[model samples]
Target chain A: MIQIENLQKEFTIHHLNKTLHAVRDISFTVEKGSFLGIVGKSGSGKSTILKSIYGTYIPKSGAIYYDSETLGKINLVTASPREILHLRKYEIGYVSQFLSVMPRTTALELVEQALLETGVSYEKAHEEAIDTLKHFDLDESLWNNYPNYFSGGEKLRLNIARAVVKKPRLLLLDEPTASLDNASKLKVRESIEKLKHQGTTLIGIFHDLEFMDGLCDEVFTMRKAVVNAYEA
Target chain B: MHVEQPILQIKNLSKQYGAGCSNCLQPNARLEKNFCPVCKTVFACKDVSIDLYRGEILGIVGESGSGKSTLMKSLYFDEEVTSGEGYLEDFHNGSLNIFTQSGQQKRYIRNALLGMVYQNPMLGLKMSFSSISNIAEKQIAAGSRHVGNMVNRSNELLNQVNIPLKRSKEPPKNFSGGMQQRVQIAKALSSNPPILLLDEVTTGLDLSVQASVLDLIKTIQRELQISMIVVSHDLAVIRMLADRTIVMLNGQIIEQGLTDQILEDPQHAYTQQLVYSLL
Candidate 1:
């Protein structure tokens, strides 16, 4: 299970002369295998919650628990350089909304890099990457081509393949289906469900209401940077 | 609703080149319907002709590479249309053939009359400026600024979207994705242009934000009485707001009808997949 308690994030804007509370005392949880949807208007601090959980954003006050493993201790918060590498190398996979693939990189090479970072064997990484590519149903012939030539949907799926190939236990997808067509989105949704069945926990910031209502096992609604309520 | 008086009109709309096209399984050009030697294949949006009515929200729904963006670009693009004519009926009422427009005409259309909103708010806004300044710049550029009007309007827009007014003076870069979007809208409305072209306006928002933004757009359209043409891959947003829908695949409008008919009982195979894939 995943649990968060009383998280707060404040940004001091010098030019604006104000302390903006991006997130305030927000908390929510996802039971194992539960697909959780976090939904809110822009600036709702939904992204802050994800960042805090992933250790990207340090909250002023809070506790995060991943199945009784205390995730909020100062030691855990101030992870060593090696430990930071380990955090990214294991446990979690992230796919962001903006297409952030490296410039001039081939789709294959992108996934390959993710594998390399995780310390997987080179030949084994190639095999695993191929399997993940086929799993997402991306065109096999285009694997060798630069992502510069890809469609929006194709690029996003490629990013997903890269993230999921390592098979991280927890996956965080921000705006996963934003520009996807209905057909492509349906396929991606299927892959996400398959991940849950494989014991992957998911936390996504989504805007597609029907997808959230149908795909999510539960939903959390946020207002003023906090999860106001949880619905099943 | 007489079809004679168009709020916005697209005549022989086409955007072509040595092909600055983005690669996809589909194409993104609006050509003269199905006649292209390139790709040894079809043009993206072939000679598309459509009329948007005042106070009506028309949606352009297409898969990636279907030339929806290209079509949109041809309309409100900073660049004038390569070939074709678009007549605006309400504000800046001009018979712009686009093909034969002077540099002044192109600049005029880019600055005024045509208000364009993109998917990424941060990418759209000027990061150096406060939200208030962003709107003010748009007003000054469009030559339509009100003294203290921007501050009042910016705060109102922030409140409308449920953001605190205290954040109104902050650089939009500091706002959340949703708040930045509101800033974009505030800027879009700064000049009070009668026609708004939204290209995936809610693209990066979370689900609740999506619903709220879609609703916000719907509400804005009604309150402002501005004609809107929204292009999106999300059929739900189109269904919720658009009076009319056009379903495009491979630069072709396979189906066009009332939003309810298209959503509930679509005619095209592609349209069926679009609606069914919603779940």
Candidate 2:
């Protein structure tokens, strides 16, 4: 479970001499294992809200409390970098619009490495990585290849694979299904549904309303840099 | 509907260790892998074959000593292959066998058309050199001499990996595990090769850092549409990034299929065990 209270995230454009209010006193609560989808027009702070939750940008005021099972309730807004890294590692996972990978490493190694760092044994990591990559429809032949050559949909699958390989308690997805074909989207939906069924809380920004409606238990429509929650 | 041609084709590729003795060569002789029970030999890879299309991500999943790494090493010319043929469609109408090329020709093909990323960063990066220099090194080797062009390209690649311009001057030794990996990625992309080969890239980073690096790879692939061959023991990584997957056991491809089909309806007992363990 997560509780966001009066979250205010402002960005100062030093050259422009202007302060942009990306998130304005937004408050929301996502229940355990619930799916919360945020949608709105462009630049509506939909992604900003997710970044705030994921700890990319610190908020000016308000507290983001994560009711963690391993570590008791910790305020994300004020958590130390190491604590945040730990949470990002073991508890929270994020899938953003971009895919960035090491130059020389293969997709399988990338995800396997993620599982290994989480303390999964070498053998288990490989097994789980293979299964996870298959779930997203990534071919076995490409697992050993570098990511520089994958298509748009293939890369998205890889990103999702890396995020959910360990099955974190909280998963934050920012437009994960963007640029995917219908078949690819269906594959991604199946995996997300599986995660939901397994009681993992999901928070996502979905430009596709239909996809959002299908997956989210609750929806937040962001407008004018604020979030308004509504039953889906 | 447009049918796609295979960008790279691997046919009946076999890599054997030690000399094949007369007993081992006998049609009825039963040999223990590369080593004949009657003689001494080792088979790293046996009659392996696959095809890679343009803009496709192919995955190879296997256990340790399954010859998965051997197959990759053979493809990249890191290891000597005993037999079989490999061809790139773009080169000489797919008539040239990559394996038979001379050392100079192989080096040119590797630098100009193929990209290989190893499991360890030490193999891919110069830890003591600045990040920009590391990327520049590859370009320089590829015959680019203009510093201005190289700097711009390096900066663009670094920016894509979320490395700031200010940090470009710093050596990868000073960077975090994830950052160093990103530097390696930028260096790999510096050449802009048609096909990229990666081996066990993210095995050491934390989950969060791994996600960032994976995300970076995703962005590059989507934006550039380069073909890739990824090797890892982990199925989860294969699931996310591969379009087609091959299962390898004991130097042979046991099962090959679409990633979803392999996961949801595994036919082979080994694949079933691999899938079942994930749950």
TM-score of each: 0.50, 0.55
- The alpha-carbon deviation from the true structure for residue A51 of candidate 1, after best TM-score superposition, in angstroms, is 48
Candidate 1 lDDT by residue in tens digits, B1-279: 112467787786765544433332244544344444444344556567778876678988977878788787777654445466777775356455654667677666656777788887765699768887887777777765576866676667667666677776789778778777877887887677888889898887898777667767866775677888999998877866776788887655677766655675455667767877886
Model 1 residue B246 distance off true place after TM-score fit, in angstroms: 0.8
Model 2, runs deviating above 4 Å = A1-232, B26-38
Which stretch of 10 consecutive residues in model 2 chain B shows the poorest summed lDDT? Answer: B258-267
Docking class of 2: incorrect
TM-score leader: 2
Error of 2 at B204 (Å): 2.2
Task: Highest lDDT: give the candidate number.
Answer: 2
Residue B161 lDDT in candidate 1 = 63
Task: Estimate candidate 1's alpha-carbon lDDT, on a 0 to 1 scale.
Answer: 0.72
